[model samples]
Target: MAPRLLLVEDDLHSRTAITLFLGDAGYAVDPCPDFASALRHLQNAQNDVPDYAAVLTDYNLGHRDLTGLSVCQAMRRTSNRKAPIIASSSEMKYWEEVADVFKLNLVPKLRHQWDGPAILAKLEEIGIKP
Candidate 1:
């Protein structure tokens, strides 16, 4: 069976692109546009033995005070707490502290760089084949 993944990204274009890419690569992605939805998914997973193999989230999710950092924290509190959490952001340097504190694998989305490959590489490194 294809591994399941949670994807939390607020940008419509980016979210659609990432979801399509990962889906084509054979992952079953549970995509969320914001922290609230992602948190709901994570909480539900906790009650049911988390069916996800990993999580990918964008650092900035709109104007909300809660960011992907909060999502990482929530995921860590779930049953699949050890599941890999990869965070991507253009301003990744500024989020290093949060990533370190939450033990998230950081994938810098540098301007002009394709994020697909970088995200896929991180997934592979974390043992998620797809």
Candidate 2:
């Protein structure tokens, strides 16, 4: 089966672009607009363990109380810590230390120069690929 991924982003355009891009790259993506919904999706998987090969979440999810970092932390706390969790944001450097603490991968926001190759490289760095 194609690798399944959880994609969380609040921006409609960015969300659509990433969903299409990853889907075209052959992943079965479960798209969510916020951390709460994404967490629910992760927690309520058919298997006790989520079947996702990886998770890609935007650093900011509107003005919510939680961010992608929170999602990564929760996943690590409840699920597999080794699974790849990537955070995307133009200001990713601001959260680099946090991501490092959680062992989450960091990728630039896709709206800029962060194209397919860039994301692919980040995924590969985290030991995930299309």
Candidate 3:
């Protein structure tokens, strides 16, 4: 079976592109537009069951309501946290904020230098196993 992945991104174009790419690369991508719904889904996953191999959360979810850092912290605090959380941030400063929230790694979305391959490989390195 294809590996399941949670993709939390607010931007339309980037979310679509990543969902298509990861799906084509043999992953089941669950795309979340913001953190509020993502948090709800994560809570449900912990309370019931989860079906994700990893979580790819965008740091800036447009507005201030649904920050990725909040989701990371919530996941860590839960009893049955089910996947490696990958935090993506455009600003390096946000890295520490989310890092303090969760024990996951961060990648800098530096213009055209966002290394998707490296991020995916690191996910594997960190025992995502998907």
Candidate 4:
């Protein structure tokens, strides 16, 4: 089966971009905008949706919205602790805040370029083999 991925990001452009590319990379991507809805999907996965192999979230979904740390917490509470969450942020300080808090692979977000390649590299590092 193809690897299932939960992609949580607030930006519409970023979400669409990643979803399009990762889908092209052979990953079945489920895109969510916030933590509550994302958790809802995780808690109640249907037969059509495959089990999530990993999670990709933005450090900040929006103003006072779904943060990566919150996503990590929900995943741990709902499922086992084996879920690997990868988050990225343009601000180093923001990414550093949640770096040691959970089992996350935090990637740096650059301003000029997109975060897709860094994400693909991390996915590869985790033996996703996609």
- Residue 76, model 4: lDDT of 80
lDDT (10s digit) by residue, model 4, range 14-71: 8888899899988888899888878888886633445588888787777575577788
How should the candidates be ordered by TM-score, best one leading?
A: 1, 4, 2, 3
Against the correct fold, how does model 1 do in TM-score?
A: 0.90
In order of lDDT, best first, we have 1, 4, 2, 3
lDDT of 3 at 38: 80
> What's the lDDT of the predicted structure labeled candidate 4?
0.77
Query: Please, what are the lDDT tens digits per residue for candidate 2 over residues 1-130?
Result: 7777888888887778877887887777888999888888778663474568888888788855798877887777555456687777877775687876877677776454235567767766766666
Give RMSD to native, each candidate.
Answer: 1.9, 2.2, 2.4, 2.2
Please say which candidate is ahead in lDDT: 2 or 3.
Answer: 2
- Residue by residue across 11-92, what tens digits does model 1's lDDT show? 8888888889889988889999999899888888888744689988888889568888888777777776788888888888
Q: After superposition, how far is residue 77 of candidate 3 from its true place, in Å?
A: 3.9
Give the top-scoring candidate (TM-score): 1
What TM-score against the true fold does each predicted structure earn? 0.90, 0.85, 0.81, 0.87
Q: On a 0 to 100 scale, what is the lDDT of residue 16 in model 4?
A: 88
Q: How many backbone clashes does candidate 3 have?
A: 0
- After superposition, which runs of candidate 2 have C-alpha atoms over 4 Å from their true positions? 46-50, 110-114
